[model samples]
Target chain A: MGDHDAPFDEPIDDPLAESLRRSLEPDPTLVPSAERVAAVRRAAERRAAEHDRNQNGPDSLRNAVSSRSLRPLIAAAALIVVGMFAALGLDRGPDGDVEYDGDIAGPGGDGTLRVVEIGIGRLVDLDTSDLAILPTGEYYELWFVGPDDTPDAPNRISAGTFHPDADGRSQVSFTAAVNPELLPTVEITAEPGDGDPRPSGVVVMSATIDR
Target chain B: MGGSSSRAARLDPTTLRQVVERARHHDPDAWESLYRHCYPALYAYAGRRLSPAVADDAVSDALARAIERIDRFEWRGAGFDAWMYGILRNVVKERYRHVTTQALPTDPAQLAQGLVEGEDASTALLARTEAAQIRRAFAALSESDQDLLELRVIAGLSAVETGQLLGKEAGAVRMAQARALDRLRAALRGGLDG
Candidate 1:
């Protein structure tokens, strides 16, 4: 037996305590199944990401970049821009697709945001890394912020809401009926599930739409 | 004697601290390693008190809660294991409350039978009578005594760690555990005689 099984300040030879300990030992077959372990792992990864976000906030990527030399930041941006072009080249639907791409950064992390006009509605694609997973009853909202918007009372159109994957990365696409040029700025906010249509004002990621 | 293979070896304090630090930063591998190390003990504690299905649910719930609130966990004398026990304790109590109301098995015989049911046929056959008797005596113990013994034996917590989780001094935990053992002995003897 490990030292943990040794009696507390008493001799280890106590037969009654020994008997109780032996009886209480869990059945070897009582181990968690593979599915259960996977489920737990998924939950842990998500919680870890959420905890990271809560501790660092939406500016985690910026803060990390700001503290280090500009080389890594420049490299990360270059990589993202290259990735955006590569994706757009393959993903370009037809003539007059009207694609606008820019950078989104906040507590969750930094990534490229692409808005493509697909005749009926605008398709918003967000590819971000180090995004935090929100707790249940909370969600991340995407918005089109107008130029004349104030911090307190902003005029914005809601695109949709999404939660990031357990790995703190989001590569999600949402379609909304809004003109990107009219709104100018794209923003993401962490919203509570209070059934309110208004933004929670907790901006997670934001970027200007390249016209 | 029957099911020793499932028991997880405790991590040393230094390694545990490092793992916890990495886990706090949202490291998936770190979180996986930590959970794997802690799962056995947590499951043992829950499994003894609850049915197999309920025990699994309770451990899962406790782990989810732990993940949700891991940022707020601070390193102290009791370490992360004890902190996890504290969380599991709450989950078990909540489950016990619900299960009791539903009239699920809460008696010594039922608990003993549950243990036996978990073992394979050969192990069950070899240790059924003695194990069941011991379990019955243990189940007959006061709630506090049961908790103390479970922490010390099933969860493999040291006296100091058990005390920390139970909100008592180490010396006091030792004293209480000794008295609990005496009561268990009397109960066991009575069972054998009767």
Candidate 2:
């Protein structure tokens, strides 16, 4: 009850969602051109490298030395944790939870896409709708082809990573402990295909999964 | 089935890693592959966050950082995208602070609770009317309110990290978030209802 009242209890959306529909309709005028987008990307990569060098200076190379040494400690702890968890009666949950994500494009808004994975639990949901039994450690990440932002600049929202059902297809399912209504659209990067519950290295596939 | 084969033609994470590893070792072919693969999205993220001029700088900086850093890349479960994002987040956050001329979002929830979810039906409806309208309205918000709303609700940054990035005292981010949210409610309701 800050300055405004809570709408959650109201449970009333725009009468017919006419406004929501109109709001979603894309505007051709605002769309980023391909040429402009490509130029920005080329420039950004050049700049990222330059900035890193300037900030880190020559000492940057040596800095990784420490990070590398600490890696083992992290890995060791992870391993011990894994071992202990395994030894305990700790039981893993059902293996059927599938995750998915995609992008949501609204004209003239942030022009930024969001994390829209639907099948996994990190930043998204475990769509129990379809129980096809997907594995852990392997999931998807989203990426776009042109400039990341609509108006200008380039940026990639992780769009989240999730476990895909073995069958790899299902109904619309999304549960977000975060913001649910404004969930981003999703695409499958196919970064991982295992049951390990993590994103694989490469983006294999992506689709603009819309609502 | 042919679609699957065609898709396989595109690099997956393992293949992308191999490409990066080759590039790290000075393999021109691998370098070319790496550039071809990551250039699009990385470039896109930068362009949107910064001006074209600064974007060029940021992108090149990230790449160079990767070159020097590529060796150190452990290729843990986290892929280059995750690693790159970690670096890019800093770049965007730095620019956000500079351009907006504001201190850290003392109250982070103001962004998420307010900007994204307005309690007033009329206000939420208005914000959802047009992305631009919302953006312009968003721009008018006070410095703290803007930051909190952008990172938490709009940009969807984590509350704890939003606090760290905004530079409020420890635990202040949370309390601030509550207050910030209140501010947002006021702004949206005030802006829209009126």
Task: Residues B63-117, candidate 1: write the lDDT tens digits.
Answer: 7777776766765445677677777776776445356312234354544554545
Q: Evaluate all candidate structures by whole-model CA lDDT and list the values in order.
A: 0.68, 0.41
Which CAPRI category fits model 1? incorrect
Question: In candidate 2, how many Å is residue A42 off?
Answer: 12
Which regions of candidate 1 deviate over 4 angstroms?
A: A1-13, A28-30, A55-211, B1-17, B100-127
Candidate whose lDDT is highest? 1
Lowest lDDT block of 10, candidate 2 chain A: A1-10
Residue range B4-35, candidate 2, lDDT tens digits = 11111225756776776775654545544554
Off by over 4 Å in 2: A1-211, B1-20, B26-49, B75-79, B92-129, B137-187
- Evaluated at residue A116, the lDDT of candidate 2 is 39
Per-residue C-alpha lDDT of model 1 across residues A31-147, encoded as one tens digit per residue:
466666677778877776666677687577668667658878789999999898777774564523656776787533468888888877888899874344443566788999887
- On residues A1-211, what C-alpha lDDT tens digit does candidate 2 reach at each position? 0001111121212321232223223221222233433443454455456766776876775586468667888788989998986676343323322233333321100112333332443233323211111213333344333333332443334434444332322223333333222433343334334454333323222334333
